[model samples]
Target: MKKCLKKLELKIYHVVKGEKIDGVHAGVYGDVTGIWGDVTGIEGDVTGIRGDVTGIWGNVSGIRGGVTGIRGGVSGIRGDVTGIYGDVSGIEGDVTGICGDVTGIEGYVSGIYGDVSGIEGDVTGICGDVSGIEGYVSGIRGDVNDAKLTDNERLSGIDVSQLIKN
Candidate 1:
């Protein structure tokens, strides 16, 4: 019985039991659940621990939005899907959509998967075993845990970033 924000022009949203779809587009979080479309904008932590999700066409999981959690455990971005794991983080326009502990030494994980937080969660994973910060940094700033580019915890406007979490 969740509702989307009209300001974001969100067209769809589906939340099953034990899940939280808190954002524009169509965000679904729960066990054995999946999102197969453009999830352009999301809000707070889309934690879906022990769940399953597939962002078919984009990284709307945290595109302009902000999210953190495990895949199948967390959010689902566009082409940069966070893959899957026990936890995810950050909000950069990178590949793998800013993850935390998703071992992928095989592909070009343009995004990051270290200990970085979502400018929100102090709960970092992976590479953060040292200082709790994003360990990936190439071209894009990769969110280094900077608390300046965060969006909102709730929908209030059309700009996706406007709803990006803390």
Candidate 2:
């Protein structure tokens, strides 16, 4: 009888093989054809895979993952920009963060809590805060908040008719 019809042939077994499958199929004499394995998550667009990626990513061509909010232009950047709150424009390199706000014409920054604006170059911070108008500033530690005097910084002793008010 054709060797008992190859011993009543019927073969079906699946432990896990996926594209989409959903739960609850215990052992012994198993046969799950396709589609039913409680797929909790997975949706559009993913490529490669290496390390460290958290949330909210868009138009990312190159980032090793450490950028938190508001990125525009970004022609070139190298590394080490941490815990940024907001606002960074045309950076060349070198920024170490605690808080935010850096508008650059040139670069080289260190441990700024907030605020450094440059039209030319060279800003060094310790407690770090300066508003506008600079031709030269060296080693500032706290409060230079909203300083605007640029007719060569009003020649070091300001009072040209109280700067034309009234």
Candidate 3:
């Protein structure tokens, strides 16, 4: 019988295979890849994740959009979500969209795009793609490649003295 209905549709898509829509407005469209749960007040266009999006009005685009093993608390994403892959843990809020090539982020992302890796926390509105950042950055506008930070002295962007550790 069609291989027992394709092995019960791959065991019911490995026991529900993501996408827990909540408070339906537009009622979900395409590419919620392997969704787990908690898309709240969605209008349309969710690309991919394991779970937990609080509020999306519309336009959640995708390319390599797989937010793997996500923690929680993404407040907003407008559109053009891209290439966010692997071990995104303890995200706080406010990603306005156009995400690109983000990898293993810790928390508090704002906007803009480029290759980011192993970020820690308080990335106050990332503008032009930081790489290997550690902690306590005030305003990053562009290019802090392979950085490690502490000692809150209000570090600005454009390679602020290679993340000043005085």
Question: Model 2 off-target regions past 4 Å?
Answer: 1-151, 154-166
RMSD per model, one decimal: 23.2, 13.3, 16.7
Backbone Cα, N, C clashes tallied per candidate: 13, 6, 3
Q: State every prediction's TM-score relative to the real structure.
A: 0.17, 0.20, 0.17
Query: Once model 2 is optimally superposed onto the true structure by TM-score, how far is the C-alpha of residue 102 displaced, in angstroms?
Result: 12
lDDT of 2 by residue, 50-155 (tens): 4443343333332333334332333233333334433333444343332333332233333333334332333444344444533444444444445466676578
Model 3: how far is 152 from its true place, Å?
5.1
RMSD (Cα, Å) of model 2? 13.3
Q: Which candidate, 2 or 3, would have the higher lDDT against the true structure?
A: 3
lDDT tens digits by residue: candidate 1, 54-102: 3445334333333364343334432333434333354344333454443
Better of 2 and 3 by TM-score: 2
Q: Which candidate ranks first by lDDT, i.e. highest?
A: 3
For model 2 the local lDDT of residue 124 reads 44
Ranking by lDDT: 3, 2, 1
